[model samples]
Target: MKPIVVTGGTGSLGRRVVRELLDAGREVVVLSRRARPVADGSRFVSVDLRTGDGLDQALTGVDTVVHCASTLTGGDEQAARTLIDAAKRAGVTHLVYISIVGIDRIPLPYYRTKLAVERQLEASGLGYTILRATQFHELVQHIFSLLGRSPIVPVPTMRFQPVDTRDVAGRLAELALGEPAGRVPDFGGPEVRDAKSLARAYLTATGRRRLLVPVRVPGRIMAGFRRGENLVGDRFDGEWTFEQFLAEHATRRPSRFTDAGGSGG
Candidate 1:
């Protein structure tokens, strides 16, 4: 197998994908904005997609490129374009993209950018596979941690199917090892969970007593989430569940408040 370059290889999903590929005895190169310490025989190349810096060298002699870098704040489209152009010039064989589920239905800013990126890849004349996955367990936990900090946690009345990052990484590595299949089926979590329910579960697991206040956020984005656009009901392909993820990591983030305090701060 030729060398595989993973963009954003320092990120949560990208790192896992790189690890999986390396574990399978594949030559792996990680593309990041800054120099990072890499062991286990993996190569690290400094590249900035935002500025198109170091991309040509990063993609050099690379057969496949797994694009896992995304900016929730902005510039996702530009980055995609930069990568597509660079990969084409490098004679890359396969280009794999990581996208979010419900990007077509949701009206969120980040989702819109992702949809744009997908279009660019399709029209770029590159052999590509776009794997749209639901939210990661760690991302969901981060949101809950911020909201659960207050006594009366304000949770959007939205449903989420948070899949494990490790599972998503495995799927990505598998895709990279095969032929490009264009846009594949959506990958989701084992079960569907609402914000309030998940928040309560998190509170209980972390020993926090916070009153979850369900907030009905109006607008197309929230409406889409409420309508289960973020959930792939029948496509629950992920093996890991939210509860299992919590069991493994929840202990590390124990609440500062104990049972003696009714509403945690």
Candidate 2:
């Protein structure tokens, strides 16, 4: 098999995908804004997706391209255009793009960008597969950090079926090696969970006694989450549950208030 090129190879999901490909005995080339240190046999190339700098070199002799690079919170269409144009120039055979579930139904800027990119891929006349995945376990951690120090964990009233990044990576690698099938079934975690409950569990794991506050966000974006727009289709399957993931990496730490001696600083 010709080498597989992974855009954003230095990112969280991109790195996992590259590792999976390499483990399967396929040569992996990582494309990023800067060259990074590689494992003994892995390869890395510096390429800026924004300006299309060094993209042609990154795609040369690469038969499969796994587009894992993305701008957080949105900016999908521009990224897709840069990659597709370079892939066409390089004569790449397969293009596999990773997208979020419910992008079409959600009104978030990020989701809107993703939906636009999907449309572009469909009309690009390239052999392409778009794999939509639910939120990752790390998303909870991100939420906690974003909320900062509060007496309670305030979460939007939303349902989620988060999946493990590792599982998503494996599936993407398989798709990159196989034929393109357009939009595939969405992948989600093994069980459904509410934001408040998940937040409570996270607090408990950290030995905190904060209340889990469910907030109803206003507007179409919030409505989308309330309707569980980020869930997978019935045909898709995943192996990890939120509890299972927590058990594997749970750590006990004092609450922020306790750390600051109950001062509301």
Candidate No. with top TM-score: 1
Top candidate on lDDT is 1
Put down candidate 1 lDDT per residue, 212-256, tens digits, no spaces.
666898898889999999898898889998888899888544556
Estimate candidate 1's alpha-carbon lDDT, on a 0 to 1 scale.
0.87
Candidate 2 lDDT trough over 10 residues, lowest sum: 256-265
Give candidates' CA RMSD values in order: 3.1, 4.2
> What is the TM-score (0 to 1) of candidate 1?
0.93
Off by over 4 Å in 2: 73-75, 233-236, 248-251, 255-265
Residue-by-residue lDDT tens digits, candidate 2, 79-142: 7898999999999988999999998998888888888888999999889999999988888656
lDDT of each: 0.87, 0.80
